[model samples]
Target: MPNVKSAEKRMRTNEVRAERNRQFRSRLRTALKKVRAATTAADATPAFREAASLLDRAARKRIIHPNKAARAKSRLTVKIAALG
Candidate 1:
Protein backbone atom coordinates (compact mmCIF):
# COMPACT_ATOMS: atom_id res chain seq x y z
CA MET A 1 0.00 0.00 0.00
CA PRO A 2 3.00 2.26 0.30
CA ASN A 3 2.99 4.44 -2.86
CA VAL A 4 6.26 6.32 -2.31
CA LYS A 5 9.79 4.95 -1.88
CA SER A 6 10.32 6.62 1.48
CA ALA A 7 7.00 5.35 2.71
CA GLU A 8 7.90 1.82 1.71
CA LYS A 9 11.21 2.03 3.57
CA ARG A 10 9.51 3.43 6.61
CA MET A 11 7.01 0.59 6.54
CA ARG A 12 9.79 -1.96 6.42
CA THR A 13 11.61 -0.30 9.32
CA ASN A 14 8.42 -0.17 11.31
CA GLU A 15 7.80 -3.88 10.80
CA VAL A 16 11.29 -4.77 12.00
CA ARG A 17 11.06 -2.52 15.03
CA ALA A 18 7.62 -3.87 15.85
CA GLU A 19 8.92 -7.44 15.85
CA ARG A 20 11.87 -6.51 18.03
CA ASN A 21 9.66 -4.68 20.50
CA ARG A 22 7.27 -7.63 20.60
CA GLN A 23 10.10 -10.01 21.40
CA PHE A 24 11.38 -7.77 24.15
CA ARG A 25 7.92 -7.37 25.63
CA SER A 26 7.25 -11.09 25.52
CA ARG A 27 10.57 -11.84 27.19
CA LEU A 28 9.76 -9.42 29.98
CA ARG A 29 6.39 -11.05 30.50
CA THR A 30 7.93 -14.49 30.67
CA ALA A 31 10.43 -13.34 33.25
CA LEU A 32 7.68 -11.87 35.36
CA LYS A 33 5.70 -15.10 35.16
CA LYS A 34 8.70 -17.06 36.29
CA VAL A 35 9.02 -14.81 39.31
CA ARG A 36 5.36 -15.21 40.11
CA ALA A 37 5.55 -18.99 39.88
CA ALA A 38 8.53 -19.21 42.19
CA THR A 39 7.56 -21.14 45.33
CA THR A 40 10.95 -21.53 46.96
CA ALA A 41 13.15 -18.80 48.36
CA ALA A 42 16.13 -19.83 46.25
CA ASP A 43 14.04 -20.05 43.11
CA ALA A 44 12.33 -16.74 43.75
CA THR A 45 15.46 -14.75 44.36
CA PRO A 46 17.01 -15.27 40.93
CA ALA A 47 13.67 -15.02 39.24
CA PHE A 48 12.97 -11.75 40.99
CA ARG A 49 16.40 -10.44 40.05
CA GLU A 50 15.87 -11.44 36.44
CA ALA A 51 12.42 -9.88 36.38
CA ALA A 52 13.83 -6.68 37.80
CA SER A 53 16.53 -6.58 35.16
CA LEU A 54 14.05 -7.21 32.39
CA LEU A 55 11.75 -4.51 33.76
CA ASP A 56 14.64 -2.07 33.87
CA ARG A 57 15.56 -2.86 30.29
CA ALA A 58 11.98 -2.53 29.10
CA ALA A 59 11.61 0.80 30.88
CA ARG A 60 14.91 2.07 29.50
CA LYS A 61 13.82 1.15 25.99
CA ARG A 62 10.41 2.80 26.56
CA ILE A 63 8.51 -0.46 26.30
CA ILE A 64 7.07 0.29 29.77
CA HIS A 65 6.97 3.31 32.04
CA PRO A 66 9.71 3.83 34.65
CA ASN A 67 7.17 3.94 37.44
CA LYS A 68 5.58 0.76 36.13
CA ALA A 69 8.98 -0.90 36.19
CA ALA A 70 9.51 0.21 39.78
CA ARG A 71 6.06 -0.98 40.76
CA ALA A 72 6.60 -4.40 39.23
CA LYS A 73 9.96 -4.74 40.93
CA SER A 74 8.44 -3.72 44.25
CA ARG A 75 5.60 -6.23 44.00
CA LEU A 76 7.91 -9.05 42.97
CA THR A 77 10.23 -8.23 45.85
CA VAL A 78 7.34 -8.32 48.26
CA LYS A 79 6.20 -11.68 46.96
CA ILE A 80 9.71 -13.09 47.32
CA ALA A 81 10.00 -11.76 50.83
CA ALA A 82 6.64 -13.18 51.77
CA LEU A 83 7.87 -16.61 50.68
CA GLY A 84 9.94 -16.83 53.87
Candidate 2:
Protein backbone atom coordinates (compact mmCIF):
# COMPACT_ATOMS: atom_id res chain seq x y z
CA MET A 1 0.00 0.00 0.00
CA PRO A 2 1.29 3.44 -0.86
CA ASN A 3 1.62 5.90 1.98
CA VAL A 4 0.92 8.84 -0.40
CA LYS A 5 -2.61 9.67 -1.57
CA SER A 6 -1.60 10.42 -5.19
CA ALA A 7 0.40 7.24 -5.35
CA GLU A 8 -2.67 5.23 -4.40
CA LYS A 9 -4.71 6.96 -7.07
CA ARG A 10 -2.03 6.31 -9.67
CA MET A 11 -2.01 2.65 -8.76
CA ARG A 12 -5.78 2.44 -9.17
CA THR A 13 -5.65 4.09 -12.57
CA ASN A 14 -2.82 1.86 -13.69
CA GLU A 15 -4.78 -1.25 -12.72
CA VAL A 16 -7.78 -0.10 -14.75
CA ARG A 17 -5.64 0.65 -17.80
CA ALA A 18 -3.91 -2.68 -17.52
CA GLU A 19 -7.23 -4.47 -17.45
CA ARG A 20 -8.45 -2.56 -20.48
CA ASN A 21 -5.28 -3.33 -22.41
CA ARG A 22 -5.53 -7.00 -21.49
CA GLN A 23 -9.11 -7.17 -22.75
CA PHE A 24 -8.17 -5.44 -26.01
CA ARG A 25 -5.29 -7.84 -26.53
CA SER A 26 -7.65 -10.74 -25.91
CA ARG A 27 -10.02 -9.38 -28.53
CA LEU A 28 -7.16 -9.06 -31.01
CA ARG A 29 -6.21 -12.70 -30.48
CA THR A 30 -9.80 -13.88 -30.90
CA ALA A 31 -10.13 -11.87 -34.08
CA LEU A 32 -6.97 -13.42 -35.50
CA LYS A 33 -8.18 -16.89 -34.59
CA LYS A 34 -11.45 -16.28 -36.38
CA VAL A 35 -9.58 -15.30 -39.50
CA ARG A 36 -7.42 -18.43 -39.34
CA ALA A 37 -10.37 -20.71 -38.69
CA ALA A 38 -12.12 -19.58 -41.82
CA THR A 39 -12.18 -22.31 -44.48
CA THR A 40 -13.11 -20.29 -47.53
CA ALA A 41 -11.96 -16.97 -48.92
CA ALA A 42 -15.47 -15.60 -48.86
CA ASP A 43 -15.82 -16.61 -45.24
CA ALA A 44 -12.44 -15.18 -44.31
CA THR A 45 -12.85 -11.79 -45.97
CA PRO A 46 -15.05 -10.29 -43.29
CA ALA A 47 -13.08 -11.90 -40.47
CA PHE A 48 -9.88 -10.63 -41.99
CA ARG A 49 -11.31 -7.15 -42.21
CA GLU A 50 -12.36 -7.24 -38.57
CA ALA A 51 -8.99 -8.58 -37.45
CA ALA A 52 -7.16 -5.94 -39.49
CA SER A 53 -9.29 -3.22 -37.94
CA LEU A 54 -8.59 -4.51 -34.46
CA LEU A 55 -4.89 -4.77 -35.21
CA ASP A 56 -4.78 -1.22 -36.54
CA ARG A 57 -6.67 0.06 -33.51
CA ALA A 58 -4.34 -1.76 -31.14
CA ALA A 59 -1.28 -0.45 -32.98
CA ARG A 60 -2.58 3.09 -33.04
CA LYS A 61 -3.11 2.90 -29.28
CA ARG A 62 0.46 1.51 -28.88
CA ILE A 63 -0.82 -1.73 -27.44
CA ILE A 64 1.05 -3.50 -30.24
CA HIS A 65 3.78 -2.29 -32.56
CA PRO A 66 2.80 -0.85 -35.94
CA ASN A 67 5.24 -3.15 -37.72
CA LYS A 68 3.70 -6.15 -36.00
CA ALA A 69 0.28 -5.12 -37.22
CA ALA A 70 1.54 -4.65 -40.78
CA ARG A 71 3.23 -8.01 -40.77
CA ALA A 72 0.09 -9.71 -39.51
CA LYS A 73 -1.99 -8.05 -42.17
CA SER A 74 0.41 -9.22 -44.85
CA ARG A 75 0.34 -12.81 -43.62
CA LEU A 76 -3.43 -12.75 -43.43
CA THR A 77 -3.58 -11.45 -46.96
CA VAL A 78 -1.41 -14.32 -48.08
CA LYS A 79 -3.68 -16.83 -46.39
CA ILE A 80 -6.68 -15.31 -48.06
CA ALA A 81 -4.97 -15.46 -51.44
CA ALA A 82 -4.08 -19.11 -50.93
CA LEU A 83 -7.65 -19.90 -50.05
CA GLY A 84 -8.80 -18.33 -53.28
Candidate 3:
Protein backbone atom coordinates (compact mmCIF):
# COMPACT_ATOMS: atom_id res chain seq x y z
CA MET A 1 0.00 0.00 0.00
CA PRO A 2 2.95 2.32 0.49
CA ASN A 3 3.28 4.40 -2.68
CA VAL A 4 6.84 5.62 -2.16
CA LYS A 5 10.07 3.57 -1.83
CA SER A 6 10.99 5.10 1.49
CA ALA A 7 7.50 4.58 2.82
CA GLU A 8 7.68 0.89 1.86
CA LYS A 9 10.97 0.53 3.67
CA ARG A 10 9.54 2.22 6.72
CA MET A 11 6.58 -0.11 6.73
CA ARG A 12 8.84 -3.16 6.59
CA THR A 13 10.98 -1.86 9.43
CA ASN A 14 7.92 -1.08 11.54
CA GLU A 15 6.58 -4.60 11.08
CA VAL A 16 9.88 -6.11 12.17
CA ARG A 17 10.09 -3.86 15.20
CA ALA A 18 6.51 -4.64 16.20
CA GLU A 19 7.16 -8.37 16.06
CA ARG A 20 10.34 -8.03 18.09
CA ASN A 21 8.56 -5.92 20.70
CA ARG A 22 5.77 -8.49 20.92
CA GLN A 23 8.23 -11.29 21.60
CA PHE A 24 10.04 -9.25 24.21
CA ARG A 25 6.78 -8.44 25.98
CA SER A 26 5.77 -12.07 25.96
CA ARG A 27 9.08 -13.07 27.48
CA LEU A 28 8.70 -10.37 30.13
CA ARG A 29 5.27 -11.68 31.10
CA THR A 30 6.59 -15.20 31.39
CA ALA A 31 9.37 -13.98 33.64
CA LEU A 32 6.86 -12.19 35.86
CA LYS A 33 4.66 -15.27 36.04
CA LYS A 34 7.59 -17.40 37.06
CA VAL A 35 8.26 -15.09 39.97
CA ARG A 36 4.63 -15.05 41.09
CA ALA A 37 4.23 -18.81 40.77
CA ALA A 38 7.24 -19.54 42.87
CA THR A 39 6.18 -21.37 46.04
CA THR A 40 9.30 -20.81 48.12
CA ALA A 41 11.57 -17.91 48.90
CA ALA A 42 14.48 -19.96 47.61
CA ASP A 43 12.73 -20.46 44.29
CA ALA A 44 11.40 -16.91 44.09
CA THR A 45 14.80 -15.38 44.77
CA PRO A 46 16.32 -16.43 41.48
CA ALA A 47 13.10 -15.92 39.59
CA PHE A 48 12.79 -12.40 40.98
CA ARG A 49 16.36 -11.64 39.99
CA GLU A 50 15.75 -12.67 36.41
CA ALA A 51 12.39 -10.90 36.27
CA ALA A 52 13.84 -7.73 37.75
CA SER A 53 16.61 -7.74 35.19
CA LEU A 54 14.12 -8.17 32.38
CA LEU A 55 11.90 -5.41 33.80
CA ASP A 56 14.87 -3.04 33.99
CA ARG A 57 15.83 -3.81 30.42
CA ALA A 58 12.28 -3.34 29.20
CA ALA A 59 12.02 -0.02 31.03
CA ARG A 60 15.37 1.16 29.65
CA LYS A 61 14.24 0.25 26.14
CA ARG A 62 10.92 2.07 26.68
CA ILE A 63 9.00 -1.14 26.17
CA ILE A 64 7.42 -0.55 29.59
CA HIS A 65 7.30 2.49 31.86
CA PRO A 66 10.04 2.96 34.43
CA ASN A 67 7.52 3.45 37.25
CA LYS A 68 5.77 0.26 36.24
CA ALA A 69 9.05 -1.60 36.41
CA ALA A 70 9.76 -0.26 39.89
CA ARG A 71 6.27 -1.09 41.09
CA ALA A 72 6.50 -4.64 39.77
CA LYS A 73 9.86 -5.16 41.42
CA SER A 74 8.57 -3.82 44.72
CA ARG A 75 5.47 -6.00 44.71
CA LEU A 76 7.47 -9.09 43.77
CA THR A 77 9.92 -8.41 46.57
CA VAL A 78 7.07 -8.18 49.04
CA LYS A 79 5.60 -11.43 47.81
CA ILE A 80 8.95 -13.15 48.13
CA ALA A 81 9.34 -11.80 51.63
CA ALA A 82 5.91 -13.09 52.57
CA LEU A 83 6.92 -16.55 51.43
CA GLY A 84 9.61 -16.74 54.09
Candidate 4:
Protein backbone atom coordinates (compact mmCIF):
# COMPACT_ATOMS: atom_id res chain seq x y z
CA MET A 1 0.00 0.00 0.00
CA PRO A 2 2.82 2.36 -0.80
CA ASN A 3 1.44 5.28 -2.78
CA VAL A 4 4.74 7.09 -3.23
CA LYS A 5 7.22 5.84 -5.85
CA SER A 6 10.11 6.07 -3.38
CA ALA A 7 8.18 4.20 -0.76
CA GLU A 8 7.33 1.49 -3.26
CA LYS A 9 10.97 1.13 -4.20
CA ARG A 10 11.92 0.95 -0.53
CA MET A 11 9.37 -1.76 0.05
CA ARG A 12 10.82 -3.79 -2.82
CA THR A 13 14.31 -3.34 -1.44
CA ASN A 14 13.14 -4.41 2.00
CA GLU A 15 11.58 -7.56 0.59
CA VAL A 16 14.75 -8.50 -1.26
CA ARG A 17 16.92 -7.89 1.80
CA ALA A 18 14.53 -9.86 4.01
CA GLU A 19 14.71 -12.88 1.72
CA ARG A 20 18.51 -12.70 1.53
CA ASN A 21 18.78 -12.39 5.30
CA ARG A 22 16.45 -15.33 5.79
CA GLN A 23 18.65 -17.50 3.56
CA PHE A 24 21.78 -16.43 5.39
CA ARG A 25 20.17 -17.12 8.77
CA SER A 26 19.02 -20.51 7.59
CA ARG A 27 22.54 -21.39 6.50
CA LEU A 28 23.86 -20.27 9.85
CA ARG A 29 21.43 -22.52 11.69
CA THR A 30 22.30 -25.47 9.48
CA ALA A 31 26.01 -24.94 10.10
CA LEU A 32 25.44 -24.84 13.84
CA LYS A 33 23.34 -27.98 13.66
CA LYS A 34 26.01 -29.76 11.68
CA VAL A 35 28.52 -28.99 14.38
CA ARG A 36 26.20 -30.04 17.19
CA ALA A 37 25.12 -33.22 15.46
CA ALA A 38 28.64 -34.60 15.21
CA THR A 39 29.11 -37.30 17.82
CA THR A 40 32.88 -37.53 17.49
CA ALA A 41 35.36 -34.80 18.26
CA ALA A 42 37.17 -35.37 15.00
CA ASP A 43 33.97 -35.05 13.03
CA ALA A 44 32.90 -32.00 14.97
CA THR A 45 36.16 -30.13 14.46
CA PRO A 46 35.58 -29.28 10.82
CA ALA A 47 31.95 -28.49 11.35
CA PHE A 48 32.84 -26.26 14.29
CA ARG A 49 35.26 -24.31 12.17
CA GLU A 50 32.62 -23.75 9.50
CA ALA A 51 30.01 -22.81 12.05
CA ALA A 52 32.41 -20.42 13.75
CA SER A 53 33.08 -18.71 10.47
CA LEU A 54 29.38 -18.33 9.77
CA LEU A 55 28.78 -17.07 13.30
CA ASP A 56 31.41 -14.39 12.93
CA ARG A 57 30.03 -13.39 9.59
CA ALA A 58 26.52 -13.17 10.96
CA ALA A 59 27.70 -11.06 13.86
CA ARG A 60 29.64 -8.78 11.56
CA LYS A 61 26.58 -8.25 9.40
CA ARG A 62 24.45 -7.62 12.51
CA ILE A 63 22.19 -10.56 11.72
CA ILE A 64 23.11 -11.82 15.18
CA HIS A 65 24.50 -10.11 18.23
CA PRO A 66 28.27 -10.44 18.60
CA ASN A 67 27.89 -11.78 22.13
CA LYS A 68 25.31 -14.29 20.95
CA ALA A 69 27.66 -15.50 18.27
CA ALA A 70 30.48 -15.76 20.76
CA ARG A 71 28.27 -17.61 23.20
CA ALA A 72 27.14 -20.11 20.58
CA LYS A 73 30.72 -20.73 19.52
CA SER A 74 31.72 -21.29 23.12
CA ARG A 75 28.88 -23.75 23.65
CA LEU A 76 29.78 -25.66 20.48
CA THR A 77 33.38 -25.91 21.61
CA VAL A 78 32.23 -27.32 24.91
CA LYS A 79 29.99 -29.80 23.17
CA ILE A 80 32.84 -30.92 20.92
CA ALA A 81 35.18 -31.21 23.86
CA ALA A 82 32.66 -33.31 25.73
CA LEU A 83 32.60 -35.59 22.72
CA GLY A 84 36.35 -36.06 23.03
Candidate 5:
Protein backbone atom coordinates (compact mmCIF):
# COMPACT_ATOMS: atom_id res chain seq x y z
CA MET A 1 0.00 0.00 0.00
CA PRO A 2 1.57 3.27 -1.10
CA ASN A 3 0.97 5.84 1.66
CA VAL A 4 1.89 8.94 -0.33
CA LYS A 5 -0.10 10.19 -3.29
CA SER A 6 3.01 10.40 -5.49
CA ALA A 7 3.92 6.85 -4.57
CA GLU A 8 0.50 5.65 -5.64
CA LYS A 9 0.83 7.48 -8.92
CA ARG A 10 4.25 5.97 -9.44
CA MET A 11 2.83 2.52 -8.81
CA ARG A 12 0.20 3.09 -11.46
CA THR A 13 2.83 4.35 -13.90
CA ASN A 14 4.98 1.30 -13.21
CA GLU A 15 2.10 -1.06 -13.94
CA VAL A 16 1.51 0.57 -17.32
CA ARG A 17 5.18 0.61 -18.19
CA ALA A 18 5.56 -3.02 -17.19
CA GLU A 19 2.71 -4.02 -19.47
CA ARG A 20 4.16 -2.01 -22.35
CA ASN A 21 7.57 -3.52 -21.85
CA ARG A 22 6.10 -6.99 -21.74
CA GLN A 23 4.42 -6.39 -25.09
CA PHE A 24 7.64 -5.13 -26.59
CA ARG A 25 9.56 -8.12 -25.29
CA SER A 26 6.96 -10.51 -26.66
CA ARG A 27 7.09 -8.87 -30.08
CA LEU A 28 10.86 -9.02 -30.02
CA ARG A 29 10.80 -12.77 -29.38
CA THR A 30 8.30 -13.37 -32.16
CA ALA A 31 10.40 -11.41 -34.62
CA LEU A 32 13.50 -13.33 -33.63
CA LYS A 33 11.69 -16.61 -34.07
CA LYS A 34 10.56 -15.62 -37.53
CA VAL A 35 14.12 -14.76 -38.44
CA ARG A 36 15.38 -18.07 -37.10
CA ALA A 37 12.75 -20.04 -38.97
CA ALA A 38 13.52 -18.41 -42.28
CA THR A 39 14.96 -21.10 -44.54
CA THR A 40 16.40 -19.07 -47.38
CA ALA A 41 18.68 -16.04 -47.50
CA ALA A 42 15.96 -14.13 -49.28
CA ASP A 43 13.44 -14.89 -46.57
CA ALA A 44 15.95 -14.39 -43.78
CA THR A 45 17.40 -11.01 -44.64
CA PRO A 46 14.23 -9.01 -44.09
CA ALA A 47 13.23 -10.95 -41.01
CA PHE A 48 16.72 -10.48 -39.57
CA ARG A 49 16.57 -6.77 -40.25
CA GLU A 50 13.20 -6.49 -38.58
CA ALA A 51 14.35 -8.49 -35.56
CA ALA A 52 17.49 -6.38 -35.24
CA SER A 53 15.44 -3.24 -35.40
CA LEU A 54 13.10 -4.47 -32.67
CA LEU A 55 16.03 -5.46 -30.46
CA ASP A 56 17.65 -2.06 -30.90
CA ARG A 57 14.41 -0.30 -30.06
CA ALA A 58 13.86 -2.45 -26.98
CA ALA A 59 17.43 -1.83 -25.82
CA ARG A 60 17.15 1.90 -26.39
CA LYS A 61 13.93 1.94 -24.41
CA ARG A 62 15.69 0.03 -21.57
CA ILE A 63 13.27 -2.90 -21.75
CA ILE A 64 16.20 -5.28 -22.18
CA HIS A 65 19.88 -4.90 -21.26
CA PRO A 66 22.16 -3.54 -23.99
CA ASN A 67 24.51 -6.51 -23.75
CA LYS A 68 21.61 -8.93 -23.99
CA ALA A 69 20.25 -7.12 -27.02
CA ALA A 70 23.64 -7.20 -28.70
CA ARG A 71 24.09 -10.89 -27.96
CA ALA A 72 20.66 -11.79 -29.34
CA LYS A 73 21.21 -9.71 -32.45
CA SER A 74 24.60 -11.27 -33.02
CA ARG A 75 23.32 -14.82 -32.68
CA LEU A 76 20.36 -14.14 -34.95
CA THR A 77 22.53 -12.62 -37.62
CA VAL A 78 24.76 -15.63 -37.52
CA LYS A 79 21.81 -17.95 -37.88
CA ILE A 80 20.51 -15.99 -40.82
CA ALA A 81 23.88 -15.92 -42.50
CA ALA A 82 24.35 -19.64 -42.03
CA LEU A 83 21.13 -20.33 -43.92
CA GLY A 84 22.98 -19.81 -47.17
Candidate 6:
Protein backbone atom coordinates (compact mmCIF):
# COMPACT_ATOMS: atom_id res chain seq x y z
CA MET A 1 0.00 0.00 0.00
CA PRO A 2 1.15 3.53 -0.79
CA ASN A 3 2.07 5.35 2.41
CA VAL A 4 2.14 8.92 1.12
CA LYS A 5 -0.70 10.82 -0.56
CA SER A 6 1.35 11.42 -3.67
CA ALA A 7 2.32 7.78 -3.83
CA GLU A 8 -1.33 6.79 -3.63
CA LYS A 9 -2.18 9.11 -6.49
CA ARG A 10 0.65 7.69 -8.51
CA MET A 11 -0.59 4.17 -7.90
CA ARG A 12 -4.06 5.09 -9.13
CA THR A 13 -2.69 6.70 -12.26
CA ASN A 14 -0.48 3.70 -12.90
CA GLU A 15 -3.47 1.38 -12.72
CA VAL A 16 -5.37 3.48 -15.24
CA ARG A 17 -2.40 3.53 -17.58
CA ALA A 18 -1.93 -0.21 -17.23
CA GLU A 19 -5.53 -0.84 -18.25
CA ARG A 20 -5.21 1.42 -21.26
CA ASN A 21 -1.99 -0.29 -22.31
CA ARG A 22 -3.63 -3.67 -21.97
CA GLN A 23 -6.41 -2.60 -24.30
CA PHE A 24 -3.92 -1.38 -26.87
CA ARG A 25 -1.93 -4.59 -26.65
CA SER A 26 -5.08 -6.66 -27.07
CA ARG A 27 -6.09 -4.66 -30.14
CA LEU A 28 -2.64 -5.11 -31.64
CA ARG A 29 -2.75 -8.87 -31.14
CA THR A 30 -6.18 -9.06 -32.75
CA ALA A 31 -4.99 -7.05 -35.74
CA LEU A 32 -1.97 -9.33 -36.20
CA LYS A 33 -4.15 -12.42 -35.95
CA LYS A 34 -6.54 -11.07 -38.54
CA VAL A 35 -3.67 -10.55 -40.95
CA ARG A 36 -2.20 -14.00 -40.33
CA ALA A 37 -5.55 -15.75 -40.70
CA ALA A 38 -6.26 -14.22 -44.08
CA THR A 39 -6.36 -16.97 -46.73
CA THR A 40 -5.46 -14.89 -49.77
CA ALA A 41 -3.06 -12.08 -50.55
CA ALA A 42 -5.98 -9.80 -51.49
CA ASP A 43 -7.66 -10.48 -48.15
CA ALA A 44 -4.42 -10.15 -46.21
CA THR A 45 -3.46 -6.83 -47.80
CA PRO A 46 -6.06 -4.75 -45.98
CA ALA A 47 -5.56 -6.61 -42.75
CA PHE A 48 -1.79 -6.14 -43.01
CA ARG A 49 -2.22 -2.42 -43.59
CA GLU A 50 -4.41 -2.12 -40.52
CA ALA A 51 -2.02 -4.20 -38.43
CA ALA A 52 0.92 -2.13 -39.59
CA SER A 53 -0.86 1.05 -38.58
CA LEU A 54 -1.70 -0.37 -35.17
CA LEU A 55 1.89 -1.60 -34.72
CA ASP A 56 3.29 1.81 -35.57
CA ARG A 57 0.90 3.53 -33.19
CA ALA A 58 1.71 1.12 -30.40
CA ALA A 59 5.43 1.47 -30.97
CA ARG A 60 5.18 5.26 -31.03
CA LYS A 61 3.32 5.20 -27.72
CA ARG A 62 5.91 2.81 -26.22
CA ILE A 63 3.36 0.07 -25.67
CA ILE A 64 5.60 -2.18 -27.75
CA HIS A 65 9.22 -1.84 -28.86
CA PRO A 66 9.78 -0.17 -32.23
CA ASN A 67 11.99 -3.03 -33.46
CA LYS A 68 9.38 -5.56 -32.39
CA ALA A 69 6.79 -3.74 -34.44
CA ALA A 70 9.09 -3.65 -37.43
CA ARG A 71 9.83 -7.34 -37.07
CA ALA A 72 6.14 -8.22 -36.92
CA LYS A 73 5.42 -6.13 -39.99
CA SER A 74 8.22 -7.85 -41.85
CA ARG A 75 7.02 -11.32 -40.92
CA LEU A 76 3.46 -10.46 -41.90
CA THR A 77 4.62 -9.17 -45.27
CA VAL A 78 6.48 -12.40 -45.86
CA LYS A 79 3.38 -14.41 -44.97
CA ILE A 80 1.30 -12.36 -47.37
CA ALA A 81 3.82 -12.87 -50.14
CA ALA A 82 3.88 -16.58 -49.49
CA LEU A 83 0.11 -16.63 -49.81
CA GLY A 84 0.39 -15.53 -53.44
Q: Which candidate's lDDT is highest?
A: 2
lDDT of 4 by residue, 1-84 (tens): 989999999999999999999999999999999998898999999999999999999999999999999999999989998999
lDDT of 6 by residue, 1-84 (tens): 979999999999999999999999999999999999999999999999999999999999999999999999999999999998
- lDDT tens digits by residue: candidate 5, 18-83: 999989899999999898888898999999889899999988999989999999989987887788
For each candidate, give its TM-score against the true structure. 0.93, 0.96, 0.96, 0.95, 0.94, 0.96
> Which residue pairs show backbone clashes in model 5?
none
Pairs in steric clash, model 4: none
How far is each candidate from the true structure, as Cα RMSD in Å? 0.9, 0.7, 0.6, 0.7, 0.8, 0.7
Overall lDDT per candidate, in order of appearance: 0.92, 0.98, 0.97, 0.96, 0.91, 0.97
Model 6 per-residue lDDT at 66: 99
Worst 10 residues of 5 by lDDT: 75-84
- Model 2 spans with C-alpha error above 4 angstroms: none
Q: Indicate the worst ten consecutive residues by lDDT in candidate 6.
A: 2-11
Residue 30 Cα positional deviation in candidate 6, in Å, after optimal superposition: 0.6
Steric collisions counted per model: 0, 0, 0, 0, 0, 0
lDDT of 5 at 44: 90
lDDT for model 5: 0.91
lDDT of 6 at 55: 99
Please list the residue runs of candidate 4 whose C-alpha ends up more than 4 Å from where it truly belongs after superposition: none
Tens-digit lDDT track of model 2 for 1-84: 999999999999999999999999999999999999999999999999999999999999999999999999999999999998
- Residue 72 displacement in candidate 1 (angstroms): 0.4
